[model samples]
Target chain A: MPRKTTIIGILGILLYIVGCYDGLLVAPADRFMGDIQRIMYVHVPCAWNTLVCFTISLVAALGWLLSGARARAEGRAWKWDELLEATTEIGVVLGAFLVVQGMLWAKPTWGVYWTWDPRLTTVAVMELMFVAVLALRGFVDEPVRRATWSAVVTLVAYVNVPLVYFSVKWWASLHQVQSSPSTVDPAMVLPLRINAFAVLFMSIGLMGLRTQLARRQRQALLGESDSDSTASSGGAA
Target chain B: MTGVMQGHFDTVLWVYGLTTAGLLGYFATLLLRLRASKAPTSGQTRVSAQNPEKTS
Candidate 1:
């Protein structure tokens, strides 16, 4: 790992620990939800970071498509393709965890393991779409073709991300509207903000590391292909 | 902490425990993968020639 990423990750972990202390021990329990509301420290941050990761994935997808087209025309390397793969993989993992965390929180608050409410339903759809993106990449053998197809698919699927965010406001649902500093108590807000930043920094570090790994894997695969082509050509000669 | 609301500490503990475990596990896996990718291997030079992005 890069020194900068390592520093950021360590700082993120420290901040998260402090935030957990504040949230789990220091913050007063809610009048209504009592200790159950403490789940927000984890649940809300996961929800927010999941959206953030998918948004990064969407941007990376666009980058891949545009850079790929340019690479074909100008003979440039396709780093964006590697980035798209990395972000999509990270996003899918985070999205799945987001759903699990939501379910955990929901069980305590809503008294159910699952609900087909708008927000929940939309997020589920979004998660499935990204999973399909990963599966789609696996099906395509050609790197360029896979990159282009997945990029287009990612853009198409990203339409649901905003839908998931606005579902609570657009339609009547069990999920609460977006939480803000104004909506939550001052004491509660501090820990929430701390945790959010911590998670964000940690996510950035993870994505950087993952992207590096993806690039290395792609390089290794390309090397094998090159060697095979050279061997076949040498045999013909 | 007078008037501190009580009850459901178990719920709080579970939430924090699970979240910490999940995130930490994920981060650790990524770090391990990164280390594996960085290890020098016989195929490393061939790959470096083909894709010169230099992930370092």
Candidate 2:
């Protein structure tokens, strides 16, 4: 685990350095966008990472729910539920940042911070769903119950991600369709492709770190309870 | 710079500023929760009583 973390961390740092330097310095300014288009380097990566994180959360949520159901029948739950919770929590954090950055990018390019365009609207919905999942976890006291419900919600809400991606194509929207991978020139593609990889690596690193922190907290909390139980029983005896 | 340039720069700064603050707030919350989770229980069952879901 430590090795995986270190490798991902080093790769992310290198990729981020190359991506930021090349994107901000070597890439050409847009004909229409001027210097403001530099926002794309950061904004686009955040957007991509959000989607990736959300998809991972959705998969974890599915595992949580399915495994939990089996565990309920068998009267045992494995330790994997903690992993689901950790991933979903990290995804929400990254997803929230993505939305904020996307809006920031919009203020300059789209002339308003927000629009009711399909892509933005769908992403907004997705963000809210994440919020709901977190709120649900806080509401329930039973770990199993919380895990089951949050997992269910996470899986259901994940359907919005693809909708958000396709929204620009499916309907009229202010946000520009993907220009780098498909229609744009080779010059634009270089930075974009590299940046995408950089963000993916960074996302993995962040997710791993966040999940580790979460599991540590879970262990600490459970350990405290076990100690308290033992102490009280001894006193009673 | 001209007024338009100043205006655009102001918007850019605000966007980055708010985002930085938001991220900081999130990290702080996570750290605080983590710390609370590790606090010793002092042979008390209040935590589980207070947070029953966490217990069973």
Best by TM-score: 1
Put down candidate 1 lDDT per residue, A134-211, tens digits, no spaces: 899899866667777888999998999999989999999999998867789998999999898888778777777876
lDDT values, one for every candidate: 0.76, 0.65
Give residue A206's error in model 2 in angstroms. 1.9
C-alpha lDDT of residue A63 in model 1: 76
Cα lDDT of model 2 by residue, A1-237, tens digit: 346854785697687668767766687766566556656665676678778777877777766556534454332332345556665666677677667777777877777878888888998898898778778878875555666787888888888889988999999988889655677656777777777787677656656556655555544534534333221112211
Model 2: DockQ vs. true structure: 0.16
Candidate 1 lDDT over residue span B1-56, tens digit each: 65444677886787788778887788788878876764334465566778889522
Over 4 Å off, model 1: A68-77, A224-237, B1-6, B35-56
Interface RMSD values, listed in order for every candidate: 4.5, 5.6
TM for every model, in the order presented, reads 0.84, 0.74
What are the per-candidate TM-scores when only chain A is compared?
A: 0.89, 0.83
Computed on C-alphas against the true complex, the DockQ of each candidate is: 0.37, 0.16
Task: Kindly state the fnat score of candidate 2.
Answer: 0.19
